[model samples]
Target: MAKVNYPEEFAGFAITDTKDWNKPKYITYKPKTFGENDIDIEIECCGLCGSDIMTAKGGDHGWGSITLPQVVGHEIIGKVVKIGSKVTLHKLGDRVGLGAQAFACLNCNRCHNGNEQYCANGVTTYDGKYPDGYISQGGYASHVRAHEYMCFPIPEKLQSIHAASLCCAGLTVFSPLKRYIPKNLPNNEIPKVAIVGLGGLGHLAVQFCKALGADAYVFSRTDSKKAQSFELGAKGFIATGIDGWEKEYFDQFDLILNCAIGLSGLNIDAFLSILKVEGRFCSVGLPAADEKYNVSPFTFFGNGSCLCSSALGSREEAVELFNLAAENNIVPWVETIPISEEGCETALTRAWDGDVRYRFVFTEFDKAFGTGSA
Candidate 1:
């Protein structure tokens, strides 16, 4: 029997089994029909995130609600190919990007107040349920359909591959950092900022802090990334594996962006112990295991430090980060892989092994899926 094809079908890669890494197969799936307020983008590049890891390796610890045979690349960059009747935000041939989110209930308070990322009725780019009862797919495909509101215009100065990662990784760190910085402070007033990991998010955080006139520091397990950290504008490097590493920097940082992937061997109390009075420990990393960090109540009260977390950023924040990157000539350190079945498999395996420098972006989607109509 011939498989039934929907009116709107796009080619993409998906994994059917979580236990098998070699199981990602190219497939065609139907997207939601174009609405008056929507636009369709022919994807140019898509960056793989740690969240993709969690989504692909499904289990109790991973994203639990993901439907099978999911297309899971959220950090997307492309050119708008088609726009609906009422889509005023973008037109045909406009360069655009979509982050981790697809749509939000515009009537919600959070959406109306410019915090749409927290909208209770929000839909994610992938593994999400849309209002029209269609499962949301992501940018790891030749074309992506999205509501116009979630589509951000990519800056002319920002490269597509870089913009793809920034749609999520850059915004994740930029949102909280921008919110925390005091507006009255002078540009020269160096706030002490520490980035907890040297991977995708932390690398971008270092650049953002430096561009925002803060003294950036990197806390890592070894000196392997020390040179790269300094090159990326870090003021200092602290290897936590070294004995008494936190003693010298006691009450040092104004804020710590905790971007580490896991809490394994991380002394949360000790990290919090070094915060200045009223300092913040903000986390953006999603752990793969059900793990808890040991922190005493006194740890919070003693240093007057607070803990907070941020997820995929709001549209406003994404724009702000994009503008900041454009102004500062900020670019993420990424390794681009040409889009192919074998290449994607290797990229996923490398990401799983924690081997990439920072980010893995898949490019040449048009060639991968045959030429897309733009």
Candidate 2:
């Protein structure tokens, strides 16, 4: 094993100011104190997520104001270099991945019930504070120290770059599909699932829905992503930008997973009209705080549908997602950029401009951080 100095101050590209968030500066800062249940990972790569940009831009965008000099990449894949005395889940040299969450009060009912992602006192991977007053940093750095439970073993068949985004985007969609879609219907009936939008989350949602025995479909404003959606196992594509697009699919879906970043001009009634009676319209994509679905009691009066949203998934769901991905060869559409200040800026800028086909994953961490093992 190559020796890591494990510097007291970790280096990363940080958002020093909300006004210029895209221009993250390379800087070194102290991480939260390592604890009995904590493990240190030498970052191999990290995935760029919409939440990272939202957090970088600050409160007005709805993700809330972040502490200055925050390192903000949560979809992290790395090798464990250090483990706490109480850590039994992982050992040195194990490749692992962590998503949006870093810590949760393990004693909580939610945690005990396999819903740790919803723990009220949960701490996010970045822009979060530990109980001892240390601000948690993220994987846009040489190393990340997280609780053992938050770290998941990466499947051998899943490449680090490919597995990185699965930490967040894949889990976000997988959790909802696993919860709403049942396995093995009495007549081998496959659930009909519609993924709204065809971006990072939606693309993964389509693959997972198909992997889980659902007949997945894509709903996008235009035909731009229609062909790719079919390639990703989508059974059908609906060009929602067209007038009267919802007429033919009335009450046809079992679930509609909304993965659009914003609900700004969405036709809620039209979407609801496509769901079967008691079907669900679940939003996993979080838009700006001010962007909301204009729905009321009458909105669901037609088919008695339910409107809901899912949080980032739990550890169990993450493990299941990785295993399922390995078995089904579920690969996300990703573009890679080496980790650097310039790379961070470009990734954030293009993602904000809706220029990425799917996700951006940072690579070449050893070249940037000199933390590669022998």
Candidate 3:
């Protein structure tokens, strides 16, 4: 193993107050004490997830009240600078990525059954606490410490910038499509899958749907994203803003994956209307706590469609997702920004305004933190 000096304190751009959360200030903080199953990572790049911005905003527009001096980022890609004695999944100097989740009880039935992401005792990568009362920080930093099980080895074929978003956005959408789409369909019997929204998660969902042998369709508010959706392997595009738009496609889709955020205006009845009987409408987007769908018990009476949501994927699914990306050459549409106060503000503001083409990844870590990149 390569010998490298680990830092006593990790530094990151943090939200000191909800008033100015988007305007993060560079600060140094202590991480939890190293444990037998933990590994220290030297962050190279971290993706800008919607959750990061929402958590920063707090109050009505955000997740909830967050711990002060919180560093919010979860799609983390870094190099293992140090590994614990019991760590076998990763090693010193190995490149890996950590997503929204940081830890889970490995002894649970859910963990054993490939649903560890839903483990009742699971911990998130940021704004989460350990049993020892140590607040977990995220990667917008020079270094982060996490349990080895939460880290996945990056494939050689994928670039760090492209692989960063896969840690969260990619995994979020991938898990649902992978679960609902059948793999044993005959070559001519391609399943028609609808991916709502054309942002970070939706774009990737289209690609994964195609990669999984399904005919991908994109459902957006307008036709503006039509061409781009097709470029991302979507076979069709549905402009849901038009009146009675769901009429033509009624009972046509095998599955509808709602990747749209801020579901306050979403037409649940219309979306569920298109699904074939017994079809699934799975959502992976996280809107504000108050933004909810007004679905009644009668919502599923027409088609018998099942409405559900998926969390971040499991460790086994993460491994499969990376391998699938590598084999299919799947790359997220990402814009790289240097990690700095000004840069973070620019990225978060644009993302909140829906100005980004797809995803934003923070790079130039060495310049920001004075720690050499791996």
Q: For each predicted model, how many residue pairs clash, with residues at least 3 apart or on different chains?
A: 0, 0, 0
- Kindly report which residue stretches of model 1 are placed more than 4 angstroms away from their true locations once superposed: 1-7, 185-188
> Of 1 and 2, which scores higher on TM-score?
2
Model 2: per-residue Cα lDDT over 73-186, one tens digit each:
999999998899999999989999999999999899999999999998889999898888788899898899999999999999999999999999999999999999856656
> Of the candidates shown, which would achieve the greatest lDDT relative to the real structure?
2
Please, what are the lDDT tens digits per residue for candidate 3 over residues 1-374?
12223477888989888878679888888888898899988999999999998888888478887887989899999999988889999989999999999899899999999999999988899888889988889988888889899999999999999899999999999998888985665556789999999999999999998888899999999899999999998899989888899999998888988888888779999999998889999989989877877899799999898889899999998999999999999999999999899999999889999999899999988888878755
State model 3's lDDT. 0.90
TM-score per prediction, in order, is: 0.94, 0.97, 0.97
lDDT: the better of candidates 2 and 3:
2
What root-mean-square deviation over C-alphas does model 2 reach? 2.0
Clashing pairs in 1: none
Candidate 1, lDDT over the whole model: 0.85
lDDT per residue as tens, model 1, 1-374: 12213236887888777775434778898888788888888889999888887887778566555687888888999988888899999988999999998888878899989889899998889888887789988877878888899989988999999999998888889988887754454555678888999999999999999777788899999999999999999999999998788889998888899999888878888888888888899989878656666677887987889988887777888888899899998999899998777877989989878899899999988778774544
> Whole-model Cα lDDT per candidate?
0.85, 0.91, 0.90
Q: After superposition, how far is residue 34 of candidate 1 from its true place, in Å?
A: 2.4
